[model samples]
Target: MAATARDIAAELRERIKSGALAPGKRLPGEPALVQEYGVAKETARRALTMLVTEGLAVRRKGSGTYVREFQPIKRVANRRLAPEGWGSGQSIWSADLNTRPMEVTKLRVDVESAPDNIALALNLTDGARTLVRDRVYVVEGEPVQSATSYLPADLVRGSAIEQEDTGPGGVYARLEELGAKPVRFVEEVRARMPAPDEVERLHIAEGTPVVEIFRTAFTDEGTPVEVNRMLLDASAYVMEYHVTS
Candidate 1:
């Protein structure tokens, strides 16, 4: 009886968790695993692949698999969305970053016809136009999330929200300046296998899933002001929400 890939992967997982294999350290390659476990090369490869698929390891082309080095970001939903955080010239994202630096890349702002769901979320009629802002969020040079925000074009057309850089508290602040300040939010979240573009954009491993979030922001009058769709690398985030009754 020979050890299966799962057996080897399990052992390796424990070793990684126990810090025997430090982050960025290469794991035993196929040949080494083959000899150590007395298993076929395919079995050894599958073992390594399992670790990669689980997000515990990464395969480097022309190199060997290494323990994943990127630290997971803690996303605090309630704190980040609280108006107090963003209303006083502070960015809502600051709650999540602490001292860590997160960069926005590939930012694009355009006016387009809203998608059906987005239009509905914003209480717009069919084919309503929106100001679409799209960007990728990167930490330590690794892309961890992508987001697209849709705001009613007529409402934001002349506002700072139409710019690539929404100053100070970001879009919410701009909306407030325009008398459409967001006072409440609702978020819907789901996990699913990554689409091809998401895999490329987030640099996610095969078999890795993504978390999709749709957040709708409304003003005190309960009029929807913005709809934001975010796709997050599941391996790169630990979502936290504060709840109260």
Candidate 2:
């Protein structure tokens, strides 16, 4: 008896999850798959398409299909917390944002042009040069979040701010080190469909939604110092915000 598409897809998915087929590794071509699975070309194609829709594989325009790396999605609750005064109260700096107590595996800094939306949020002139920091927040030796933070190059370049690598701290701590204390932050939250790249990077299933957070941090004098956009997989994590009034 011939195996169904679902059966074939399930076998492939198991292989992917079991590490038999590593991420970023290319799967056998359709002709090879057809021969191996004893299926027709159409059946093999359908199986491959199913993998793509499930966020397990990505097909580039000309490049062959590759297994998409699985990135865990974490949920953080959004709540208003008691405002901490300067040099008072426990801060997020004291708590590890890595959640699973994982070490920083990768840190990348690049000079990049700002997207229109980022430019508007940061009040930058169009086509401005921004220092972008890409970090993968890992937990228990696995990637949980992939973050890309943008800043005015003039504010962080050639400073110790870029030197520190790992600790129980965040970008806010680095800003404080630079004498720019962030006193308050305003966050805007929404949900949207994940882009193709996001779908692949996050390893989210089809029809799954993502939470989008836009955060604007302010200095002690109420000047906007930083704007950050965070995308989270809704199924794996939730945002928690505590408020005291």
Query: Whose TM-score is greatest here?
Result: 1
Question: Relative to the true structure, how large is the alpha-carbon lDDT of every model?
Answer: 0.92, 0.67
Worst 10 residues of 2 by lDDT: 77-86
Model 1 residue 51 distance off true place after TM-score fit, in angstroms: 1.7
Task: Give model 1's clash tally.
Answer: 0
Give per-residue CA lDDT, model 2, range 17-70, as digits (tens). 999999989977788888888999899878888887666786766777789764
Model 2 stretches astray by more than 4 angstroms: 1-99, 103-106, 164-168
Whole-model lDDT, candidate 2?
0.67
Residue 66 of model 2 has an lDDT of 83
Candidate 1 ranges with C-alpha deviation above 4 Å: none
- Cα lDDT tens digits, model 1, 156-238, are 98888888888999999999999998988999999999989889988999888999999999999999999999999988889
